[model samples]
Target chain A: MTGTGGRARYLWLGGLVAICLGLLALAAWQLVVLERQMRIAATENMIWVFGQTQIEALNLALALSDEAALQQIQTRFDILVSRLTLLEDGPQRRFLENAGVSETLARWRSGLLALDPAQGADPAALRAHVTALVAALRTKASLVMSHEWQSQATRLDSLRHLHLLALMSVLGAAVAGLGLVAILIDRERRLMSGQLDHLRAEKLASDLERERETSENHRRFADLIAHQFRTPLAVIDSAMHRLTRRSGGPVPPELISEKAAVSREAVARLVKLTDTALMMSRLERDAVLPSLRAHDLNDLVSSVIDDLMATAWDRDPARIRQSVQTEPTVALCDPMLTAEILSNLLRNALLYSPPDCRVDVSVFQSRDCIVCRIEDRGRGMSPEEIECAFDRFYRGSGHETLPGSGLGLTLARDLARIQGGDVTLSQRDGGGLTAALYLPKDDVA
Target chain B: MSLRYHIVQTALMTALVFMAVPAAAEDVLLTLTGAVTDGRVEMTRADFDTMDWHEFSTSTSVTDGRPEFRGVLMRDALAHAGAEGSSVRATALNDYVVDIPVEDFHRFDVLAALYMDDVPLTPRDKGPVWIVYPRDNHGVLADIRYDMRWVWQLVALHVQ
Candidate 1:
């Protein structure tokens, strides 16, 4: 298509241009012809000139018969010479020469000029000489008139043929130009359609890639759910079974209380896992509607930190450090969603780093938003891991022993978005991951 | 055949020369008859010379070179006879004839040229009175339609 289609277009364009040039040349030629016709540059009516010469010769003969005045006779003779002069020069000379009458016309001119008034000839001899010239003049005039007539007819015929040729060329140029325009328009339409098809193909390819990635994520999520929930559920089942059995007779009061405590602890773990799953499902179905308002971001962060310390036996308050860019760090967001987002980051920081290392939590006010950054002194993940940190069921590779449902970061991001905010994680400068929570700036505050 | 016909035609025309002898007699080179209130008006070289003369230079179809011409306008010439009509029939010494619209007389100062380069016109050199148009001034005059109107060796004007 490239070779043949491109060549054909060039050929069509070249041919049209050539035809237009030819038409222009023809038009210029026609203008020249019309100019020649308009100028009246060639007005020698040869037939009339020839007939006048013979007529004037005879006019002298008539004057001679009337015994007219000498001056009148001389004038008539002079007039005859003037008429013959027409046959002797210019365009008329060329015509008579073509007729092989130049010699005869020259001879007549000499003979007539010889009879000039300066010679003072008598009337009789003058009459005889004019009578002689008239006889020969009569013979040549008919021949010349016929020659002029035939040439005029041929000229007219050829002029008609020229006009026909010019008309056909004009029509040819018009058709060629129109054909060129049609081809260009059609080519433009085809090129646009081809571009649209290419764009559609690209979109389809990207859509297939995204679908495969999502299916892979679902397969990993299935395995994670089985491994994470099976342990807690199995512990609760065994403890309940031991307490309800009658084959061991009445169990000791101490053993019964201890077994009951173990069962209750496992039940709490199961409840936490169930709560995380329920919250994720609610976010996925777009069921959670956040109530937006201006709240102090620092208040939410410090409250989340307090709750984490109270819940875990090993999480020490002295191991955490807090900083604030402004007095309150105010931002526009739902208070509940902001607290949930902050708690997830604080808990992850406490769980991953060594128990003795201090965790840093900072709240700052940027130009358009309030940002809370929680930095931990744990081994930081790679760029690739950080990028996928917000995916459902995602966990750091080496932190499998850490207590987490793996839905923390994903839930945090979803809840923040519902409140018109977002969360991002990055590798800290020294040796840990930094999680940043952003909320819209509180203009009223 | 054309020669014999021309001879008889010339004899008849000479016999019918309009019998216009007047005070100028042999000097009378042109005549006006028919539709002239004076019945017949003969114009000699002297008669033309006495009229108000105008000069215009132009090249003619029958000749080679540009020549200056002096003449009285046809309207002025016809006024001598008090001639009136829509057009006039012009005849040459060779019996060449063409109709000139009366509008031509007033429209373009159509001249009955009596002199070439200040020389009195004799009958031999497109003279006595040749009908000259101001060809150089008007592009319309440089065409065959006007070419035929430039009658030479002119003899009579029958106003009608």
Candidate 2:
């Protein structure tokens, strides 16, 4: 159910960031604890405490003559003993142990322990002990203070060293985390850039493919134009040359008209070929938008059939049969474009079929459109040819040698489509091709 | 009582017990003292051979290649001297001392080697007795600390 991977990736990144923050927090906490320990160590210097105890003991001995003084002396003695006890056995002994202070403290502790406060309550005895203790304390206190200062300095150095170590470790962790993050970002950037590059490459490839197709189409058009124009031009030139030679000889009037007619026919073919090619080029570019007008479908088809029959050179006119509806069928279309469409379809029907075969033309109104169907009892196109029948340069199978530029069907289709209509070629029933043309009906219809 | 008294008594007893002892037991290679029930124990190559001899092949930093070390286990050697301690301060011929925890002998098959390549070693060759751990067999022991602990020409062990 959880198919979106991008969300998971962001969650992992957030988790990693949280872990890095937690590590930093832990390091800061440790640093705070170490700082607290350093502060406490700095304030609790035992050497100074030991010196104060000695001063208090001396004061107690001076004040031991009265009851209040006696009680004060007892308290002072207890305090001095406690200080000595700290020097002897407390955690601070490690600093004083290496110094010769341990020996002096040990001797004083033993002597002081042997002297009971109640048994040695006499002020004279207490004074003697206090005086000796003071002398011993005086000699050792400064030595102990120097030792303690040295130890504190050493401890401070070690703490600074530890602080530096912690700082370096935290910095190292930060650098490592940042380096990993940088690597991930760089990798993501590269992946994104790679995807962009792939898309760009794909677009460039398609562009190259389209350019290649355009150039190929241009090359085919050039060959077709040259071949189509040269034949007609060559026919006209030969006919004129023949006429000029004959005129220089015996100028026969009947042969002259015939020769002139042949040249005129060739010239007409050249002009028609040029016009068709120019129209095809314009239609290919979608440069001509249709100018529609109301026209009778029956008249349009009948006129087209007459023009083909008049131009029929080898075929008999009786082979084309037309069936037009007696009722007026008006359609909205470009008249000249409709004529070009009908002419191309009729010509193809006449040329593809045998001269003896019948070409049928029918025009009728079908609902909102005017439909014209042309059927020929000729060799029908295969499924493949029928599929590509309207493609620019596709002359049907077995019709390559036929007098055609292969643009007739394409031009007919383009012309029909320009007037909000369409032309389709299909294999007619009983082995022949049929072309159906449809044009939009007039608004009055 | 005194070291001289005990030495004299031992000499008299040795002289009386075996006047024609073998020369193999004559050369003492390792000495043990401190926290030992025997007070002191001197081990000759013959005395080591009398104990269990374990043969193991291992390479050492001081050696060119893997060689078969024939020796008694450190635990057996310590037992021979009646050693009772948590750690042993091993001393080399060059006076280099290092504290080896008794746990090392218990943890690994360490050796007090008397011979290298079936030949008795002298002080110059880093032995009359050498403390060797199977460094090649146990990769964990192949470290500088363990290498330093492998004292060559091991002359004394003070258990404490």
Q: Give the interface RMSD of each candidate.
A: 6.3, 24.9
CAPRI band of model 1?
incorrect
How far residue B59's Cα lies from its native spot in candidate 2, in Å, is: 46
Clashes of 1: 1
Candidate No. with top TM-score? 1
In angstroms, the error of model 1 at B40 is 31
Q: Which stretches of candidate 2 lie over 4 Å from their true place?
A: A1-44, A47-76, A116-120, A131-139, A159-222, A230-268, A279-347, A354-377, A387-392, A409-430, A434-445, B1-160
Candidate 1: regions farther than 4 A off: A1-80, A99-104, A123-149, A170-197, A235-293, A303-328, A334-337, A355-358, A382-393, A401-407, A410-422, A426-431, A443-445, B1-160
Per-model TM values vs. the true structure? 0.59, 0.47
Task: Give lDDT per model, in order.
Answer: 0.77, 0.75
For each model in turn, which proportion of the native inter-chain contacts is also found? 0.37, 0.00
